[model samples]
Each structure stands twice: as C-alpha cells, then as structure tokens.
Target: MKRIVFFGDSLTAGYGLHKPEEQSFPALIQRELDAAGLDYRAVNAGVSGDTSASGLSRLSYWLSGPVDVFVLALGANDLIRGLAPSGTQRNLQAIIDQVKARFPLVKFLLLGMQLPLWVPGQRAAEFRQLYRDLAAENEMPLLPFLLDGVAGIKHLNMHDGVHPLAEGYQIIARRVWPVLQPLL
Candidate 1:
C-alpha cells in the first residue's frame, strides 16, 4: 500500500470543527481511496496554527524512514502572522530536500494558499508566486489555492470564517482527488 502524508496547518488539522475523523480533509481523502479500492494510507500530519518554520521543526517526525508521497500544505499561518514569504518558501523547500536526501523517491503535492484581494495586491501576488515558483522548481503538483472555490463563501466556512465546514471539506476533497487519485 502507498502512503501519503498530509502536512499543513489549521486547515489540515480541521481546527474549530466539531469532528475531525468525519470532517477532516485527510479523512475525506481516505474515504475517496476506500471507495476506489485503493490500498493507501493518508497520514494526517496537520498541526493547528503551525507556521512553515514549525512544520520544518517537525520534519524528522513525519519524514523519518519512508514516506511515499507528501501533501505539503503550509504557509497560511506564516502569511497570517506576516512572516517573510522567502522564509516560508525556503523552509518548505528545505523540508522537501531533506526528505529526498533520505527517501530519494518520494513524490510531492503542494497545497497553495492565498490572501484576500482586499490586501495589497503586490504583496499578495508575491505570496502567491512563492507557491508557483516552489512547485516549478521541485516539479511538484501544486494545488493553486487550497481554498479555491470554498473561500469567502458564507455557507462553506465556519462562523469564524477562517476554517471550512463539513461541506467545505467535501469540496476540498473533490478538488484534490483528481490529482491524488492516480497516485493512491
């Protein structure tokens, strides 16, 4: 069986949600795999409010031994906290490099994040390009925006509007499954 590690912040962790096992995006992906008769494990490495640096810090824990494919979803918290975009990109790239140093054959899928258009367009564009540039450099499948169709939708997000609701995760699962299906 193949294994895919999902590394991300609050979104991956399904923060503020009433249930994780039922509503977490990773779990939803697992269901997809099951229905497709794919023998795969979707390991949820999500940490609530984790920054890129934080994800890098937990590197050894997730990348140890062997990891078939990595679902790298991070940088949102870093952006929220106004951390340097270069730092986020560097940390993420370093993680992939380190994993390759050990596993050599591991594949990757990076989940990109974005800020609202109301924010400074220049800074936002730079942030958006970070994912694009990194994915291009690493040749990883990049999900342009993890919150692509769900963000800013009143019914799709929770009351806090920072996290997705059940329906939102379903949408996320649907969007990601296309790229993830063959891998599993």
Candidate 2:
C-alpha cells in the first residue's frame, strides 16, 4: 500500500486521547481510506511540542520509507512559543523540499493553522498568511485551518482548550477527506 504521512504537532498526535493510534486524524483518515478501498497507509508522524525546526531536523527518519503523499500540520507550537514566521516558513519549506527530493511524485496537502486575533501585534496576521503563501509557492492544496469548525467550540475540544476530542478528530477527518481524496 502507498503511504500518506501526517506530520505535525500534538494535534496530529492526538494528544490526551485514550487511543490516539486509533482515534487520531491520521488514523481516522486511514479508516476512511480503507472504507473507500484506497490502497494507502496513513502514517502519523506527529511529535508533541515540536516546532518546524524540530520537524525538519527529524525528517530523515520519516523519509526513510517510501512516501506517496505528505500531509503537513505543523507550526502550532511555533505560534504558541511566539517564533518568527519567517523561520517557521523556512523550516517547513525545507521539510517539503527534502521530501520532494526523496519522492518527486509525492503529493502534498498542507493543513493550515491560525492564531487568535487577541494575540497582540501583527504576528497573528502574518502567521495566518504564511500557510497561504507556502501553499501557493509549493502548488499544493491547502486546508485553510485544521481546526476550522472544531476550534473554540467548548464541546469539541478537550480540557486543554487546544487539542480536540475524538469527535473533533472525526470532524477533522471529514473536513480533510474532500481535499485529500481528490489528491489520491
């Protein structure tokens, strides 16, 4: 089966879930692929508290295997830690570049993230635009925000008010399927 790597932070890792292996968005997508008769294996490569730089540093391990599609969902930690958008974008771009160099035919689906408007300064706006710019430069399909309907919804997220619950992941899987399915 072909491999689809879901690379990101705690959200991709399904942090705090009782069964992340089975309930994470990547896992949910795996089930969807199976139900749809798609011959693809979803690989969750998310690391909690990981920044884009960390991801870039550890990318070689994920690249060891054959990759058919790359789903990038990083940068949340960067935003939380108040990192520079330029650095985040550069690190993310490097990850994509390395993956492309290894697997030229691999498709990419970028999962975007946004900061709350309450966050002071222009950083919030810049953070939001970086994803769009990256998608445009890479010519990849972009999911405006990974937590679209789930974010800020009391019932959807866990107590942390950051990560989502299983139901929330299900919503994410649903939102991702349309864009992801077309690529497959």
Candidate 3:
C-alpha cells in the first residue's frame, strides 16, 4: 500500500486528545482516504515537544520504507523555544534532503506554523518566512499556517492555548483534506 507520513510535533501527534488514533489530524486524514477508497496509509510520525533538529535526527528510521507523500509539520517547538529561524530552516532543509535522497519520488506537503501575536515582530516574521522560503525553494505545496482556523479560538484549544482540542483537530482535518486529496 502507498504511505503518507505526517511528520511533526504535538499538533500532528494529537496531543491533549483523549483518542489520538481517532482524533489526530493524521488519523482523520486516513479516515478520509479510507472513505475515498484510496489505497494508502497515513502514518503519524509525530512526537510531542520535538524540534526540527530532533525530527531530522529521527528521519532516517522512518525512511526505511517507501513513502509516497511526506507531510512535514515540524518547527513549532523550535519557534517556541526561541531557536534561531536560520537554524530551524537549515534543519528542515536537511530533513527534506534526506527524505528525497531516500525516496526520490516522494511528494512533499509542508505545514507551516506561526507564532502567537504576542511574540516579538522580527522573530515571528522570520519564523513565518522560513517555511515560505523552504516551500518556494523546494517547489513544494505549503499550508501557510497549520493552525489557521484553530489558533486563538478559546473553545478549540487546550488550556495552555498552544495545542488544539478534538473539535479543533476536526477543523484542521478539513483544511488539510483538500490539499492532501489532490496529492493522493
């Protein structure tokens, strides 16, 4: 079967959800795939609190099998921890490079993340630009902001206001579906 890997941090991992396998965006995508009778499996390679660097390091293991599509959703933790955008960009590029090297035919869908409005201007701008630059440079489709509709919506987020609740994931799944469907 063809495989689509959802590689990222907490948001992709369905953090704070009671039933991750059923509620996570990746799982939700899988459900859509199944409903459409698509012969594909959506693999959730999300690790809560993981950074771009860590994702890069663990990429090789996930590369063991054939990957038809790679949905990169990392870098949020890097931004949250105040890491330099340059470093995050570099790490993300390296990860992409490694994946391409392993699976030359693998398609990519980059999921971008944005900092809260409370963050400093330069940092937030830099963070946002990194994903845009990467997608442009790689000629890949990018979801401008992964949390576009869910962020800052009090009822949709967890108490920490960082992660989304189950309902929020439902919205995210809908947003991601159109982009992912064409890929499949």
Candidate 4:
C-alpha cells in the first residue's frame, strides 16, 4: 500500500487531544482515505515540541519506508523559540531534499504555520513567506495556514490556547482533506 506521512510538531501530533490517534488531523485523513477506498496508509510522524531542525533530524527514519506523499508541517516551535526564519527555511528545505534524494517520486505538501501577532512583523512575514517560496520552488502544494479556522477560537482551542481541541482537529481535517485528496 502507498503511504502518506504527516511529519510535524505538536499541532500535527494532536497535542492536548485525549485520543490523539483517533482525533489528530492525520488520523481523520486516514478515515477519509479508508472511506474513499484509497490504497494508502496515513502515518502520523508528529513529535510534540519539535522544531524544523528537530524534524529534519528525524527525516531519515521516516524516509526508510516507501513514502508516496510527505506533509511537511513543522517550524511552529522554531517560531515560538524566536529562531531565525532563514534557519527554519533551510532546515525544511534540507528535509525535503533528503526525502527527494531517497524517493525521487515522492510528492510533497507543505502545511504552513503563522506566528502570533506578538512576534515582530518582519520576522512573522519572513516566516510566512518561507512556505510559499518553498512550495513554489519545489512545485508542490501548500496550505498557507494550517490553523485557518481553528486558531484563536476559544471553543476550538485547549485551555493553554496553543493546541487545538478534538473539535478543532475535525475542522483541520476537513480543511486538509481537499489538498490531500488530489495527492492521493
């Protein structure tokens, strides 16, 4: 069976969710794939608190098996930690390059994250533009904002206001479905 891997940090890991495997956006995507009878398995390779550099470090392990599609969704932690956007972009690009080196035909989808408004405007803009640049350069799909409808909504987020609740993940799943469907 073909495999699609969602590689990222806490958001992709379904942090704060009681039943992550069943409620994470990747898991929901798996359910969609099953219902559509697609011959693919969705692998959730999300690690909480992972930065782009950390994700890049683990890319080799995830690339060990056949990967038909790779959903890149890291960098949030880097943003939170005030890491340079350039560094995040470079690490993300390196991860993609490594994956391509191993699986020349693997497809990619970049799930971009936005820094909260509190961050400096210039840095935030740079961080936001990185994903667009990467997606264009790589000729792959890009989801501009992973938390489009769920972010800042009191009801959708957990108490800490960083992670999404189960209901929020459902919304995220729906938003990601269209982008992922074409890939599948």
Where does candidate 3 clash, by residue pair?
none
Per residue, candidate 1 scores C-alpha lDDT tens digits across 58-129 of 989886646888899999999999888889899999888988887788888989998876787667878988
User: Which lDDT value does model 3 have at 45?
Assistant: 98
TM-scores of all candidate predictions against the true structure: 0.95, 0.97, 0.97, 0.97
- Which parts of model 2 are misplaced by more than 4 Å? 117-120
* Tens-place lDDT digits, model 4, residues 1-184: 9999999999999987899999999999999999999999999999999999989988889988999999999988998899999999999999999989999999999999987657678889899889999999999999999999999999999999889999999999999999989987
Clash number for each model: 0, 0, 0, 0
For candidate 3, the 10 contiguous residues with the lowest summed lDDT are 114-123
Model 4: how far residue 119 lies from native, Å: 5.5
Off by over 4 Å in 3: 116-119
Q: Write one digit per residue (lDDT tens) for candidate 2, span 62-163.
A: 999999999999999998998999999999999999999999999999999998668767788889999999999999999989999999998999988999
The model with the greater lDDT, 1 or 4, is 4
| Colliding pairs, model 2 | none
For lDDT, candidate 1 versus 3, the one ahead is 3
Give the range of the ten consecutive residues with the poorest summed lDDT in model 2. Answer: 115-124
Cα RMSD for candidates in order:
1.2, 1.0, 1.0, 1.1
Evaluated against the true structure, the overall lDDT of model 2 is 0.95
Point out where model 1 deviates above 4 Å.
none
lDDT of 3 by residue, 10-100 (tens): 9999998999999999999999999999999999999999999999989988999889999999999998898999999999999999999
